[model samples]
Target: MALDFQRPDPSSPAAVASAQFTVSRRGYREEEVRDFLRQVSVELARLLERERFLESELKALQARGPVDVAAIDEAAVTELLGAEAARVLTSAREAAQAMRDRAAESAEQIVRDASREATRLLEESTLEASRRRSDVSGEAEQELELAKQQGREMIAEVRAYRERVLTDLARRTEEARRDLERLVHERERLLGAFERARHAATDVVGDLNEFDQSLRGTGVTPPLVPPDAPPPPRASRSSDTPIFDANEYAHELGAAHREERTHEVSANDVVAAEVDPTDLGQVDVSVVSGSPATQTPSTDETSPVEPSLVEHTPVESSQIQESSLASEGSQNTEVLPTSDTPEHIAEVVNIFDRQRKREAPRATPIHDAPEHPVFERVEAQPEHEVVAPVTNRVDEIFARLRTSNTERVAKETIKDLVEPEKPAVHESVFRLRDEVVTPAVESMTRALKRQLSDDENAALTHTRAKRTSLTLAAMFSPVEEHTQRYVESIHETITSVAVDAARSLSDSRRADLRSTVARGEVMEAISDMLSSDLLRPLHERIASAIDAASGDRDALATALRSLFQEWKSQRLSIVIADIAHFTYARGLFLGCDGATSVCWVVDPNGPACADAEDNALAGATTPGEHFPTGHQHPLAHAGCRCLVVPLDK
Candidate 1:
């Protein structure tokens, strides 16, 4: 009986060594065949060990749960098994003839069974790994996307908050500018009203002087002219009256009248110096001329004196004589009426007459001058001369004039009248420098510092948000090295599954095949699984995540930079605006160094450093004109290094 050679376990070296093959002319030596079998058995044992591991893994997978049918169909298993069995049988037929043929057939059956089992196991393993890979990739993608979304939201929120701060700063700056304008307008109105009041007061004084001159011309006290004095030549009163020609009067009045006129002119000069020319009316020379009492009267009672003179005639002659006598007795009395009005002279005269009459009764009235009628008619004077009004109560008028004279003299003593308030304004500039400008600059500095601090915090927050997102994305994304390591592990699992399945199928079919050839086949199967299905989709998913993560990181960096720049610019603007508002409100001009780098627009138009130096040396009276927009004030724009200076007119 031919020794029925059962299918020897490929893992057993002893079975291969003891087995007897049918000897034929084509068969090889038993020793050489045994040696080949020994080599095959050794390789088979290695493959079996791998198969056992794969089987155990497959059992573990099956124990966990049911696998999808679509992943492992019987037809696919049969095809894979048949292909592997054919390759193994071909190798067996080439190695040993009939002894190997039987072994090949038995081994072919076993290889087919093993290949089918391995295919099932490999498919199950592949499906489980694919599902796990899908779950991991989905979770990583979701986490990375969530992190990116959170980063975007944080950046947007920071930008919105910065915009709000900038808007509020601009609004506050506008309000400050408006308030400054109102204060300047109010100051101007006050100054104008004060000037108007001053002018009005000056006009009142001039009116009083004119009225006093009119009273003096009433001739309440007559000049003590000797009767023998020849009548003065009839001079053209036209030139004499208007000019108050002391030379014309000297010829008629002798030395005493000239001396009196000189004294009156001196007093008028002193008063005139105190007031502006615009406040005074046309220069009336009649103010300096004495009344007819100081003049040599013409013999004809009806002959008209200058109408300008006659209109100033006194109502009471007796009262004048009495006061003149009383004044002469006490001291060297002035012949000109000192009283501003005719009525005051009359009151003084009445009191003097009572005293004189009581002292010695004038048996014959002291004078020979008759009482001139209040309405005594006089011949008309030249048409060019202005007519003075005929008055019935000259005493009452003179009384009021005396009161005005006293008041007018009193007003001229004030030293500061009509003086410009430049000194006060300069002092106010100093006060503003100390109180407003200094504090404003300090406040602006502090505010900028605070803004810088806030900007830093905002930038830090933005950086942190971006960095955290990036870190999370890197952690969760399959693109990162750690995620790559996880994918590599999955690839290894799939590769191992494929290799084990290929090896198991090969080992079952041909124990005589060389270890290198079997390994090559197993490797080819693993390579196919990696290139075609197992690792390709995973690599693509990781590649896409890497591309997205890279884009998001770049975008976040750009956004953070833009936000920081915007915040910095806005903060600088607020500081500059605050400084400008404070300086302008204090009636100062904002000045710049005129350097090109400070601000191109402001530098060209701004005051030079020398100009500011000159202003500081010379006292300032007025504020400078408003500058054009963009160059309107100190620190008008960001990075401005200008100064606030008092405007020197």
Candidate 2:
């Protein structure tokens, strides 16, 4: 049967001390049992007090937060009872059992409460973590959206800027075209004037030749015919005629007189025509005189003939006609009477001799007559005013054509065309920067950020390695695109350079036909230039960038920055160098400043310099042959900063 024992108050130390236990056969003595019971009761009360204290502390801990129930060792508390409690409490076994049951129940209740509280707190913490994760995800999404929007805005701005640049380029090109037209017109005018002058000079030469032939046919030596004139054809000589034939002599005299009359008519025709300065040396005034007697006067007789002081007076045609008619009438009426005898013939001859003598002094000089109107008009003109109006017109035309301003306009036009192309290259690079590089870098940055947000224990080395590999792999396509774009840009630039070069050559009056560059040749040259100046260098730079970017995040950013900078600065320069190389290979020689700069040191005695000097001397008569070395070809050494300029030729 179970015994119902009244529980003692653990707070009463006296009740615990006075506790008793019933004795039985073969059991301990009553006094000893009672004493053991007292001890057991006291220990039981102490254990109860400890249980209550632990329960209160556990409740306080539960109020604060979730308790670590696993940390609370109940087995340790049981060990604190020791061997004395087990042995002595046996005599009061029922009571002891009751006490132990109560203590275990209290301990189990405390443990159950702590476990429930801990579970509740764990659930709350998980809910909080879930909420925080959701917030972070939303914020990240917003940030990403904002980044995309900014990227779009940036692209729009870039497009607008490009449009502005293109507009400015178009305007400049139009201005250059107009200037080139003006230069062309001026050049054509000069050429036309030169041709006209040449034709006029030829006409004068033909007229002088005809006059010389007339003088030779008339058996009169012309004083004006140069020694270089062809000798007249000689007639075959007959051995039978030892003396002169009278008929031949008379025929020669008659021909001579006819030639004189022809010459007089020709002189009149020439004076009536407009004369250019180019015709001045062609006209022979000495051939106009008809009488050989007047031409071959004795030196003593000529010395005694006083210089005739004749005024340049205008003479009427009617008065000259009347004088000529009166002379003819007087000659007709004074004809000799019929003379069959020698005495009558001598008398008639004497009368004619006196008549000729009287008429010689009365004859007017050729300068005063309508008979020699051409000579009279020529003698009346001032010596200084001999230059024709055509000459002055030619001089003015040439002066307008030969201006330095025209040369400057041509040079500026070429420069504008060539220079605008460089900016196009720049724009292409900038587009690559915005479209390809910027997006790629942004993606990489986001990937890095995502990687950093992973758990601390995450495989950092493996993750970074994988990320770097992926980034580098992805970079290849963009790099290839960039290379292709840059190649195309370079091609366009080179093509423009070729066009500008051709235009310059065409504009240049001194451009040599042998040196004229063809479009096909320029294209071929560009291909050659691509290998050395564009493709190889670009590949090396991109490869180096990839290699550098394979490190930490900082290293990657640095490499990307360097790559962009190289594209902007170095790559554009490479394109320009390629263009220059193309121009050089196409026979468009460029001038260089030989002074020490980034390109090369100018050693006066160097082979290149010597070659340049020799070429300069050889092409001295040809303008734009100044620089020796860099002028002939591209001076594209590694890291060279030399600017190749198109020579004027």
Candidate 3:
């Protein structure tokens, strides 16, 4: 921008003072310097004018005597020159004194005007600061509250997502268990069906075989045997046993007689081959079927038998089962009378081999025996009820809680928040809080304190508390158990702090301070701080922490806890210090009788920079704690060193 240096009032003091100048690395502003030089030249011109007036007066007075050529008398002219010299000297002294008086009067008026202007500006500044602080504080509080709400909501959402996932997994697990049970049931049912079908087939095959035997006239069917027929022959030894005579029971006498003749021829061939051929016709066969001494069925008569309904005692049934099991388990075959054995030598031959003499397996009638008497005993009992397969009811139940795509997407986002990058974001927010947020809040607060009057501590403390709250809201992330009760705790802590800071002041002043703290500033700094330092940064950090997490749930939970607790302790302590200082400063400003000596409030456990001035200064309360107004604030520096809280003893 260009400025006209030759303007009418360019060299005026106001112009000189208000002039804008180009700042340089190594030199003063050229325009301001030039304007100032013009002012100096103007002042020099006035001084020259005054000097010329005094000199012209002196010359006029010297010329005013009008002495003709060196005066009429030497003594008289000398006396006249002396008087004139005295008069000029008197006039100059009087005029100089009058000028001094007038200059002093002008200076006094200027001082009074400047003082009034300064007071007006200060008051106006205080009111403006109070108003700005009030607005900023309120806005900051609402925003902080909103951010906290969001943090809490986000926490709830993520947790609910995890729960849903777990519930889905559990449902699937239960469904799988039910399916397994159904499978096992089906297997058992299949085995049961197979056993039933096999048992039925075995019974059918046995009936067929018996019918075939009866047709061939080899099996004795008792139901077909005549009731009037002579009783069948019985084998005698140890226990009397009846054996069936097929020839006696046969209705076709001719076929029976022919079968007997054929058996006799075959029996003779076997006897002749075993003994001498000439002696075969004279050989007599024993009729007992199972006896070692017995031969093949006698040609003279069919083998003896009992009725078809022959009932055995319990002992006989047990014996039959034991014999069947033993015979079935053994690999050796029992030889039946094959029509070739000599009857005369049968007894002597069997006596020679002990195994042949052993009791043989009984030839039980197929008509009397039950099918599969050994294992499939269910034939006599009821059959198993068919088990129904598992229904789809369980699957439907499992699917009941299934989420829709939109809900699932939300869930995925929540679950994905635990990715590794989340914690890094958290760490960044925390870093920003520690580095940028805390210092900015404190710096702005200190600057506000400088601008505000002593009366507006309520506003001062309110603003401080609000700023603290906003910072906390930015830093809080609720992951586990409210993460040190983030939202709930901040309001109380900050409120108590604000109250405590203003409590020591008078009721009216307290109210005014609160209102003022809520209102005041040089506004640009306050507005800029709220927008840049508090609002934008707080939400960004809140977004960073809430929208993300640590590695996983547990780690994320830890991150949340660390963030909250860190903010709680560090910022709270600083806030308390700020309030304490503000309270003391206000008391001092109010000239409270209770505003006593001050004490250095710093970490006594660590090396303190505050003690550098005086070892006593770090801890000492001025005067004594015994005094009522023994407290004051001694904020010595901006860096983290010491804040002096006035002791209100």
Candidate 4:
């Protein structure tokens, strides 16, 4: 029946081995896979580096343009065209001026021709009158001659007046013509200049259009064209202010001001150093010369740039003085009261004089009193608490405990079992501890210094000895002797308690044993406790006394072996209460050797225990829980700082 392969008890080695395999499979060895992953990571890093290089090359190639070189030459050509347009405008202005001079000469010729025509008409009228007088009879001639003389006188007077009016009219007309001609010349010059500027703009616009076309054909995007960006005006050399195009000046000034203000703090410092603080106070009270009493409207841009100052007159004193002078002037007026009430005015003046005398300053006696300091001293309480004396034994005993344990007793116990402590424990511990730990610590420090010096001979290792002295002193701190004593004391106490428990079990009524056998069993538990890996170091230190008392070597060996085995298998069990409370304070951040200070210790559980250490040793306990599930302690938070003490047998 196939050799009964599935039997509970295997009869052959191969069958037994098959049963073991059936019970549990072997776990995969992850280290080989992890090593493979490392190689993959290196390959990925190399690929990423190559990609970055290619990406940089691509960006550089993308930054270049085929049209940029041509664009620069085009820009220079455009500038030359602009210069030629300016030259043409200058020639046009000169031509306009010549045309204006010719028009003025034509106006002068028109005035001269009108004056010659008037002279000819006057000569013809005189000859016609003479011929008419000769043709008439003698009587008629005499009458005619008298009439002629009267007519001649009237005619000559009329002609003389007409000539004066004509001459005046011609002079006024010529003046008006000259004025109009000058205005026309100015208009022509302005029109020509404007036309020339417009043509220059058109030419520039045409070239820009061609450039835009060229850019598009080359598959290149043209830069954005700014609106109406006029060329900057040339500055006159004599001007103090730098030449700035008003449109761009705001942007320029903003940048300049930012740079200046970055160092503007220095200007204020300079001002403070140079200025007298007292002078500023006086300047506040004083008024500048030429300051107007009343406010006035501001004029154009060339207003004075002087810093304006103001003065505040002492109104009360000025008003009092003004009133006194006015009253004196009024007294004179009262006496000269024209013709009436002169007698009454003199009486009023005498009354006023009596009032002034009553208001005069009075003489006073001075009494000197002793000068005293403004601030009087008041008694203050001391800043630090006064440390009480160490009188109670129980308080002193508990003070030797760590802060974590002392706090637990304080929280658990009712009433004041311990007095308020002085900080004497720390001082006392160091004093006693120094006596024991100083020589050992000093020897260890010297040994470490020698090793460090040997290691530092190589260039790469030299830095390791940089803080050798400080490191040695700190690592071998003699003050920790008290802590060592406390740990040893606790271990010894546990050992004594376990011994008593074993002696009690030996005397119990239920179990049967030979005297030798029973003694062997009790000692076996002790040996197991001592030999166990978890407790071996602490157990050896405490077991030295017990070992000396036991006489038999064979019995002692069995006892120690059994003690460790039993203690590990049955007596030891650790209860992991939550350490949540200790999380808040974290641990003391003291560096042991030359390592960096790990300020806080975070618990391994999670963020709830973020301030706890990864594997903090609270108090050593067994491998299993001591308390039942429902019987957990009050301080069970993950970072509580409370620890379970060993309950040994």
Candidate 5:
């Protein structure tokens, strides 16, 4: 298949001619041919030498040329040709034989030349074939070397490709494994959170119990404490007890002691005073008289006498003693003591009569005395007569009572002015988009359900009501078809909203803890929260709708079931939150430019904004079209809020 570049050596005509001459002429000798001829000549020369030797042998018995040369024998040849027509015949024959030998030699020379040319051609052809073979072998070796290099390159390429494939496969496998691990870890985290939430409910119960116990221990008697314990003690007593005792006993005792002790102690005290001017003494007087204190005293005891006269002389003392004895005898005659010994007192003439008689005689003298004395006389009034000034106290008390009543009236008037009057708390039905529509839908549903089962012309009544209600639709729209379309639109909108909410919640949740939140507790808490305005709207509307239904209890139960069903389908996201960050981030949708703008907030550490921004974002419905219509998130209200923040590290 490969071409050989060797042609017939590009032979010229002259060379061809030369080669032909060398073959045909047999004596041509131009360089290469000469050398070739020389070799032929040497061969011829050996043939000649052998011919000579053979001729010599022929001379002895004669051969024509050499036997070793394989030449014709001349003599044998002459005899065979005809021994000379005796000489002439022999010469003719010999001539014929010589011609034959010469012709044979020439033929032999031509044959030798032809053989040499053939040999030369063969040698050149052999050389050309050898060179062509060498060239072909070299080419084959080079081709083999190139093939080996190509093979190595192919192997290297295969290895690189294998490595790349392995690297890609490893990357993909690692990515898949990481994704799986992340999912598993997320599920675990959800389970942990769910368990904690369940525990929180129980923890709340425990907290309530602990709080109750703490309150019970704080001074309020616990149920465990006994009831018959002693009462706590107190501090002051009545002041009148001591004052009344002193008034009852001291006055009587002091008065009785005054008369008995006056004479003896006064006399001794006077003697003591005279002997020692600085002496201060109290005289004790005992009252022995039997007469009552209310009885009149004798005139003799009332008369004033000079104490200096009694202390001056015995005669004066004797006169004073006589006067005192007579007066005492008269006093004893009027008021006797229970102890009637002479040591106590003695009977005497009527000194009281004598003093009375003397007082009548000194009446003019007494009347002649000075109008004003050195000492002022103090007259004590009776206790009964002293109370006369307080006679109008009852009237004053009545006046005070009237004044207090007027003041109380004035206080009430002032209170009325100061304190705002509270409007009477009454149940009112507030009509709002959710409020009115929610109840109406509930009512319609209940009515429809009732009509579906009842046979009291219920369906006919409902149809009539429906028609009448539709008639009222004229207030908003004139066309009945338009009203129907609107209603259908509302239904579709609400339904779509509900379905989306359900799907979002269901897809996000990784766990549930329903068993931990008992129905009783949930209901109790919900009931309490219903009092707040945040929940009041929904709670009141629901309650009212239920109450107004044809089959109230059943309707309420059905409604509750619907609500719960919706919640369950959404994984209780209305109450339970998952993917809380995404849900909270939805608020950012508010105030967004619907025309062209989109927000690009940082979720670097998950979606947690500051409290102020978050608050500003709460319940800001993203226009009518953007609001999540039937969502039941517990934090959907104006005040309630929460969010999630992923911890990347």
Candidate 6:
């Protein structure tokens, strides 16, 4: 509602309505306050209508006529006025109480409405705040999950990178170690070769000296002897001394030198210088070369280049070479007459002579005999016959000239084509093994190494693709393809060894064996044997090895490496042995063949156990009449080194 009041500036909200009050004893006339009274009457009427329920009883009593206060009545009027005043007083008190009750009800209702509005606003704000908080929390959780995922990926990447670095470092380190070992091994080999050459030269010097001394005693003009060469360096002894042990070579040939020391004679006394030549098988041929040196001109090629058992101290070939080279440019070179010698032997002798002629001269040829092959020219045959008789004589002279190396086989005990190993592999077996098994095993190992790398990378990268993998079942599963390749390589090596062994027999004998059994049948049996004895065991061994490695990748690789090496080395040996034994036993199967019967020879010197040796010996001979089965094969087991020897009737 709008209201206006009289003021000095009525439009301003700060302006106050003002009125002057004149205090007097008399009351103000009604006419003077009529406007204020009329305003009051209208407000009073509106207020009564608003509180009509509270004023119903007052309205009912208002039906009585009005009594004016100015109309004075004496005693009668005084009593009547008293009763009316009492009734009006009662009505006014009742109306005032009802109005207070209504006001209280209105105030309570306002408070309740305000309280409800405030509660609704508070609830709405709280709900909106909760929703925003929830959204932010959800976003934060998503970001945290994303960061965790990124961190895991980064860790995997870093770990993979670390693996690569370590693997490279390990490979380089291994290569360097192998290189160092190779260099050290080469150094040792060179040192040994140097020592052996020095010893040989020392021996040559001593021999030349002894030859000159013998020539002087025999009344031939002795050549000037060479100065003694420096002693060969020796291996350090337990006492750390550089001196060598007693010369075993010199000791063995002490008999030849004993005669020289025992008999001293004048140069003119040929009879006294003469010694029995029977004990000197190594002596007879030496002076014959010098005999022709005294006289030249034997042009007869068939003149039995007169080999004699001339007992004299022999000269070293090195000295012969030295003397030869010194006079090579001065003399007409000999075209050597061909002799009936082995082709390989002739080739070797030719090479030796050519080498001697071309090599640096070690000693002067001032006393070289004209009979020396280099000085005397011989007419050579125009064909395959290459080495001449003079070359043969020179070869024989050189053959006995140095320390006899016959000690290597002088005793029957050391006579073997090749020594048998714990698991015997014939030396000839290597002819095919190098071509087949070794390369296969190497490739297999390389494949395994690659597999290890792949599996390792897979493990690093796929850690959480499904559930975390904790075991090795997924890593090193055995590959059948690798095993098959392994089997084929072994088959190739063994088959080749067996075929070569059979081919070694005479053609008729091979036919006899083939007649006794079809070739394919024999091979099939052998194949079955290999499958059972070799391949099955190989697979089992690999499985056992993998199982033994547990879950460790390095351990698995190490086990595989060792197993592959064994397959290449020891297992190959066993396979070759069994195949060889089986091949020879084939001929022995039928008595008509070259082999009459077969027996197992357990090397007394081998590593075979006593029980095994005895068992082998007990069943050594398998008669041709009673053909042997696979069970009777000479190879008892993987490590058995027994030999199958065929006997003729």
Pick the TM-score winner.
Answer: 3
* Minimal lDDT window, size 10, model 6: 341-350
- Regarding TM-score, does 2 or 5 come out ahead? 2
For model 4, the run of ten residues with the poorest summed lDDT: 343-352
lDDT of each: 0.42, 0.42, 0.42, 0.35, 0.36, 0.45
Better of 2 and 3 by TM-score: 3
> Candidates ranked by TM-score, best first?
3, 6, 2, 1, 5, 4
Q: 427, model 2: CA deviation in Å? A: 49
TM-score of each model, paired residue for residue: 0.20, 0.21, 0.24, 0.14, 0.19, 0.23
For each of the candidates, the C-alpha root-mean-square deviation to the true structure, in angstroms, is: 33.6, 32.5, 29.3, 62.8, 47.0, 35.2
Whole-model lDDT, candidate 6?
0.45
Predicted candidate 1: what Cα RMSD to the true structure?
A: 33.6
Worst 10 residues of 2 by lDDT: 341-350
Estimate, for each residue in 1-649, the C-alpha lDDT of model 5 and write its tens digit: 2212331111122222233333325454345444434444454455456556655655865345444434546665566444442354334334435434644665576578879989999988975665455435534655676699999999999999999999999999999998787667656655554455445444433343444344323322111111122323544433321212223333343433355457768877676565643221111111122211222223343233221100111123344345446544554243322332211111122222334433422211112211111111112222243545546889999999999999999998988896433222112211111232344344434432332223112222232233333111221223333223323323432333223322222332212212222211332333233223212333344445445654444444344334323323332232222212222223222212231322122222223445423332333332223223233222334333332111110
> For model 2, how does the per-residue alpha-carbon lDDT over 533-597 read when each residue is reduced to its tens digit?
54466456646755765656555433443443344444544454334534433332322222121
lDDT of 4 by residue, 1-649 (tens): 1223334222222332333212212222334323433433453455456557656755775577443445647455446335554344444344334434533543454445545656776766654443333223323544566699999999999999999999999999999998787667656654554455445444433443444344323423212111122334654434233322324433433443455556867866686687565443222112112211223323432232222222222224454455446545554342221232111100001111234433533443332211210111112222357999869988776777767697788777856566532111123222322333334334333433332222222211221234432222222223234224323323332233223322332442223222332343323332332234223442442255235525443343333334433433333321101211211111110101122211122222334432122223122222232232221221234224322212221
What is the total number of backbone clashes in candidate 4?
31
lDDT by residue (1-649, candidate 1, tens digit) is 1223463544343454455545544343445445555656565555556557656866886799986778867665555345555454444434334445656665565567667778989988975665455435544655677699999999999999999999999999999998677657655654554455444444433333444445546544433222223544654423211323335434444444556668978977786686565422222111112233543323442232232221222324454456446646745444443344332211111211224433533233222232321222122222256889977698888989999998887787564376433211233333333343344445444544454344333333343454354432332333344333323333333233223322322333233333333343433432443343322443454345445557464444334333334434444445334333323322222122121211111123334554333322333323333333323334333334343342321
Predict model 2's lDDT versus the native.
0.42
Where does the lowest 10-residue lDDT sum fall in candidate 3? 371-380
lDDT of 6 by residue, 454-517 (tens): 4333433333235644343453344444344444544543444344444544454545434445
